[model samples]
Target: MYKIENLSFKYEKDKYALKDINMDFSKGDIIGVIGENGCGKSTLFMNMTGILKPNSGEIRYNDEKIKYGKKDLYNLRKKVGIVFQDPEKQIFYSKVYDDIAFTMRNIGMNEEDIKKRVEKALEAVNGSEFIDKPVQFLSYGQKKRVAIASVIAMQNETVLLDEPTSGLDPRSTDAVVDIIKNMKKNGTKVVISSHDMDLIYEICDYVYVMNKGEIIKAGNPDDVFMDEKMIKNAGLKTPWIIKIYNELKNNELKNGETKEETNLKTIKTKFAQYK
Candidate 1:
């Protein structure tokens, strides 16, 4: 639904926050951008979502180039929504229902439709109980869910989730993952920016590894994560599943596949004596 070509962004005279980045977000995929802190993952998201224009390249949404004019951006943002890494940056309303309804109201949706959208968005985030609660009273995770609910209420065809699971506990993170999957099931393109490798490995259909504001590797998860040298150079570690398969199989990449189930079956064969 989105095409980013030769995109580059600079924050200062000589340094680029994002350099020569290109990405495609099809209608039904979970794309992951993985890198260390200060690696420009967030910067890339900003440019793609039209919050920050690129210094050199262009971004297209649904085959049309994105223009940053006031009216242009207003319409673009309606199709491409983003949830920030910190919920505070996105959550502006004191109450849950208001926050989720904020975007729809901005577009002048009737009250009845806004209420139904609010309820459905809250349900997707598993936050129905929070609909009437004060935003300040919710925990950090709950606040994050509310922030996501606000974005989901927009029902954008493409969604950018900046560190969606950051600072979240396992249960909360899993909830976020499930919500993301549901977005895909409902036909939204989900682009995730995170440093968490395991989460990327498990949920992402594709990945790009970045360092120093440049993407050093791009491919399906197996090709991107299984390259130990590339992962190390990117200042990230392979996911635990890959690590286990390597240790159990004497560090050899087996049959050119590193998926969880494939690796698990390999590990089981090594300990077949347990049977």
Candidate 2:
């Protein structure tokens, strides 16, 4: 759905925020960007969404190069929704319904249609109860959901979420996870940048490992997360699921069980615990 080639960006001369980056979002149910803080994951997203133009190289969405012109950006953003890490930055209205309706109103959508979209969007994020509540009265996680519902109300084909599960209790995190999965089930492509390795491992079919302003590795999660030493070398943590699975694999086999049999049983049990 998206392709970036040799992308580079810098805020100041000779100081690159992102350098020589190439990523293909051409295939995957969920695509993930994993890196340490300030490692250019967010910077890359900004470029992809046209918030920042690249210093060099090209970003293409659906076989067309991003033009960065006023009308081009308007259409692009309309199709690609972005949810930043901080909900407060995105929440403009004090009331939940108003905040979610802000974007639709800006586009001159009729009040009746905006109301329907807002209701559907809130329902998608499981935030219908808080629709009439004041934004300040909601918890951090509730605000986050409201922020996401704002974009969902726009009905974008693709969603770019930066740290979707950051700073949330387990229940809230689980709720966000379910919403993300449902997005895929409903046919919206989701790309997320997060430091949470377990979230990436659990949801992403494909992953990119980034450091020092470039992607060092890219592949299916099974192969990518399987290499703990590599992840540590890249200055990132291994997913807990991978760590446990590797530990289990290292221990000696018992009861004359075949390796494949043991792996199937153990893997299923571990995955079920997370589910």
Candidate 3:
């Protein structure tokens, strides 16, 4: 669905945010990008969505090269939707309905079509209950849901989410996870940038670890998560399941399997057997 080759970005002449990154993503894939603060995760995302053109290299979608032109970028952006880390940064409409409908309006959807799409999107995110509520009055989590609904309503082919679960209670976090799973099931290409290892382990089919403005590792979650040295070097914590499995392996416990079997349930069972 997307290809980025030798992508580099610089805000100032001396400060480079991304360096020669290359990646290819397929449709209906859920890819997780993890890195510490200022590792160029957001910079890469903005470049993908055409919010910021790369200083060099190429980004393409479906074999069509994306150029940094206003009209071309605008059309390309319609097929790719991005949800920022903060819902408040994206929500500008006064009412929930308006916020969800704003994008449809900008895209010039007719009133009847916009209403239907808005309703479906709200239903998808479970935000229909707040359809009439003022956007400013909703809780932080609710506003986040509305932001997601607004993007889903656009029916974009690809969705890029930045820190979707930040600053939420457990219930809210689960709700976001559910929504992301639904999106994946519906065949949307989902790319998420987060520091939360647990969420990445649970939801991402593929993982990319970034450090120092470069992707240091890319693989399935099991492979990437098993590399404790790489994880620590990137300033990311290993997931609890992986940590437990590592400890068990170090102690040479029976059935002390590799990280491939280090899922939550398997880790629990291994500990139980030792007990």
Per-candidate TM vs. native? 0.91, 0.95, 0.92
Residue 246's lDDT within candidate 2 is 68
**Residue runs of model 1 more than 4 Å from their true location after superposition:** 251-275
TM-score of candidate 3 on Cα atoms, chains taken together: 0.92
Count of backbone clashes, every candidate in sequence:
0, 0, 0
Rank by lDDT, highest first.
2, 3, 1
1-275 per-residue lDDT for model 2 (tens digits): 78999999999899999999999996697999998898898899899999999999999999999998999999999999999999999998889999999888888999999999999999999999999999999999999999989988999999999999999999999999999999999899999999889899889989999988988889988888777777987778887767767666666344434545345347858679876
lDDT of 1 by residue, 220-270 (tens): 887887799989988898888778877756634555344443456565466
Of models 2 and 3, which has the larger TM-score?
2
Estimate, for each residue in 1-275, the C-alpha lDDT of model 3 and write its tens digit.
Answer: 89889999999899789999988886228999999999999999999988888888999998898987889988887899999999998999899988888988987889999999989998998888898898878899998899999899999999999999999899999999999999988989899999899899878989888898898999988889999899999999998778877876666555655434434567757756874
Scanning candidate 3 in windows of ten residues, the lowest lDDT window is 255-264
- List lDDT for all candidates, in order: 0.87, 0.89, 0.89
How large is the C-alpha RMSD of every model relative to the true structure?
Answer: 4.4, 1.9, 3.5
The collision pairs in model 1 are none
Off by over 4 Å in 2: 253-261, 264-266, 273-275
Q: What is the lDDT of residue 109 in candidate 3?
A: 88
